[model samples]
Target chain A: MSSSTTPALPMHEVRAEATWLQRNKMIVTPLLFLLPGMLFFAVYVIFPIFQSFGISLYRWDGLGEATYIGLANYEELLTDRNFEISLVNNLKWLVLYLLAIPLGLFIALFLNQTVMGIRLYKSLFFFPFVLSQVVVGLVFSWFYLPREGLLNTIITGLGFDSLNILGDPTLATYGIIAAGLWPQTAYCMILYLTGLNAVDPEQVEAGRLDGAKGWKMLWYVILPQLKPATFIAFVVTIIGALRSFDLISVMTNGGPFGSTRVLSFYMFERALSEFGFRMGYGSAIAVVLFLIMLVFIGYFLWQMWRDEREARRG
Target chain B: MFPTPIEKRSRAAQITYQSLLPLALILWLLPLIAVMVFSIRPFSDFTQGNYWGVPSSFELFTNYGMVFFESDMPRYLLNSVFITVPTVIGAVALSCMTGFALGIYRFRGNLLIFFMFIAGNFVPFQILMVPVRDLTVDMGLYDTKLGLILFHVAFQTGFCTLFMRNFIRALPYELIEAARVEGVAEWRIFWFVVLPLMRPAIAALSVLIFTFIWNDYFWAIVLTQGPDAQPVTAGITSFNSQFVAQYHLMSAGSIVAAIPPVAIFFLMQRHFIAGLTLGAVK
Candidate 1:
């Protein structure tokens, strides 16, 4: 009987061998699937960062021959008034942009109820975030457009003089920041809404039973649970503040004596725009921005690492 | 759940709250509403201080026509679509593979690579500006949609990869083990077994990317200059310059430029929120 089944045994062995190959195929297959993506990412994203760092060390117009400038651009940046102004404005933005978090929390708390047509109201509130910043800038510019603008029309209706929010050097930056806050606050509201959804109802009930009410309930029980949402809102708001170029460009073009020139927009004006294409100096400004962001990036990465490790351990 | 519900309050409080709701919303949206109203108002309304009043005449069509015919609005729209669509497709497709590899495979540098992506996603765009622009010019892709698309796809990969990897990681590991025991190839396991389950993630990512790339003004301005490659955001800047003081036309153009992403948000509001708040809840 064993000899009669020998041919069938060979066929069976061949099928088993094929099965073994298939089972172990992943050992070699993922590389094939990952190559194209990795290549594109390396070329377009990863490599360019290093390339930019290299370019920062040299002086070159985009078209002409390149010349190495070493720390000369950095030396100039140390004494550059415009760079200082831009840096100061960025600090202001960082400080003021944080207002979005509290404002967003207020709005989120206001709209958290299960009222009739609440969904439509929520969406309507979120409309600003959906639109482009350019549109937001335009809308705000019109609103801030002297006496005939919406803001002034309302101010005058109350018998106050029309305020030129964008024209005044002192107020221009704040005006632009206010426009930025509109969408950013909406963004934060959405995050808080999500966070509110996951709040421990039992904790809330217990707090209420303990005679906690109003601000006490919020301060003692609710706000602590919304830490994750607050953290993200703070992070994105800071980044948004630092990267605030569009509103500056659209609203006032960093006008009224360049009072609103954040580092990001200042870098763009120096490097690319018609501001003499000072590539090396522009790179220097970028390096400063990069250094500022590096601090936060490191913190965020550390936090994320800790979270992941804790998740895995649990 | 955090605050006392409006209904549980006294009658006067509820009435006051309801009244304040619309008022707060109106104040919050005053700028946007002003633009919407101005888009339809005649030029005289702006000139004659009738901004907040009813439009003197319905000039919506005429103003919208001016944006397209009098300016390079059509070209700008095309440029935006060209750059955004390709970037979304390329970034999503690449991340799907990268995500699968990093999520499932136990590798030495997996965490390191994932962290690289997360860090890269947060870095300031200005830091990458000089070298990226130079590279684009070197490759003769500057002032072209291709240049913009390549950069966007690359930059967006950091984000897309982070999202995709986290999404893929949350799936049950046993599915892959079972597929392996059944003698399925790894690539086949990814394509036939895991890929189908990524539909919700893909949908979420696609809409998010579409809105992000479509509304990107920074790269649009940095990479391209002329109408030939200028996206709507940058194009509007130029139009603002050309049509300075023509508030009616500018408002119309703003509305036109805003339509696409707003439409996307309404269509995929759930996915958009989910994608945005991926890490917020937990």
Candidate 2:
């Protein structure tokens, strides 16, 4: 019972031991664990942002010396017609891509029940999102092919003239957007399905007891709980819309008179592709795209921060 | 459950709903179904204008082999695996540490760093494209699989860190505190205690990152040019161009390019969906 009193160690020895532990563990341990990750992240991700910003003010073809030219590229962007087209197309993408959220919610609702062979149904529906965008683009391109394509065949079978979707500038952007929606809707559906799983059954039953059903029940009860899912859906859809390069690249190569060009594809064309290595102009385009994204980024961070604060409080 | 179940509906309504499901699915997936059919059909079917009929002959194996023998499809597949695997392991390993640091620790710049990751994760690839490419070239990694892996690992770390941090933060802090009070070293606590709990997160991220990197066409085109480093997504582009009129071969190649990720998804559908919808629901 009195073991503490039996052995009295020197206070200096105890202090020395505690200090050594602190030095070796608290300070050194975290450093060892953190250094490798932070270093690479800083070098490749964090450093590149500032470096790109710096290069945006210079005229350089990736290899040669970067000549200083402050704001000239940005100034040129103001009058560039293609930049204008890309910007407009980006706006169109942002608007049209939001459709996926509702479409996905509908699909999720349709498949939410426990039915026979439902697992197979869900997987089949989820199949599109699993495939690569390259495949999606190729498939859609074939679908939109002029004569023998699925779309034209369907149209011609109905005694209508074959509609040239990818060939027509006005319809080409919409055509690509539709193809993009195929997977995006699937992604949204998965999110909504997960959301639906966690929804309180009691609330639905209570709403039913109160004679609230269908859209009324959804708006009044279900949607409130689905806020988190909807917020994520919105954020991802927005990001997907802005970062739509692969589909545009594969399906049209920003072709049919550059009408379908978004900023990402346009930037790629300017900087990397065989079109021309106007690195400065490309960076300028990148800067604009970055600025556009910054708005949403700020909003997303604020929302996340607020949510974390609420989570902490709870 | 919010909407009325189809079973409870009138018989007419039930029949309409049940009958419409397959039709809707078919219409929704018409493009994909068309490609699937075309991938199996003989080349003569296209030339003969027998687009809607049964395939003249099933040529799936022949077409698939043609993609590999006639083109750089094998190299592309190898490049994809090379880039994707390393990037997944590297990003996940790094993020586990960073996430532990940010999530478990209460430091001055913790929130700042977390928000930085969140913001950085959302930035367009274009913003980083020029300098990233230049940096890769300067480091002598341009047009190499290593260059693609490096960028992907770095880029994906932003997202992975966010996910891992939130996941770790949700773990009971008392366990770490209890270990520390027992005089356990911080690194040991992380390795023995925290790392084990991260298996689910790691699995989810592995599948998700595998898909993202495998399907990445942009970086493949940007960082790597030739067959030596190009992944299947970009390689399929070249295949498409070479087989301009050969729809059967192109379709076959597209199917081949899609198989890996599709297999991963089907094998791990639950984890894949869970990973995708991680932040979507509370």
Q: Please, what is the TM-score per model?
A: 0.94, 0.95
- Best candidate, TM-score: 2
Error (Å) of candidate 1 at residue A19 is 13
Query: Which lDDT value does model 2 have at A118?
Result: 74
Q: Which candidate is the best by DockQ?
A: 2
TM-score of 2: 0.95
How would you encode candidate 2's per-residue C-alpha lDDT over B1-282 as one tens digit per residue?
756777887999877877777887898888988988888888889889998888888888888889879888998899899999999999999999989988887655678888887788899999888888888999999999999999999888889989899999989988987776676767789899999999999999999999999999888888899888999999888878889888888888898999999999999988887788997778
> Against the true structure, candidate 2 has what lDDT?
0.87
Candidate 1 on A123-156: residue-level lDDT in tens?
A: 8898799888888998898899886688888888
> Lowest summed lDDT over 10 consecutive residues: which window, candidate 1 chain A?
A1-10
Clashes of 1: 0
Worst 10 residues of 1 chain B by lDDT: B102-111
For candidate 1, the C-alpha RMSD (Å) to the true structure equals 5.0
- In model 2, which runs have C-alpha deviations exceeding 4 angstroms? A1-17, A20-31
CA RMSD (A), model 2 = 4.1
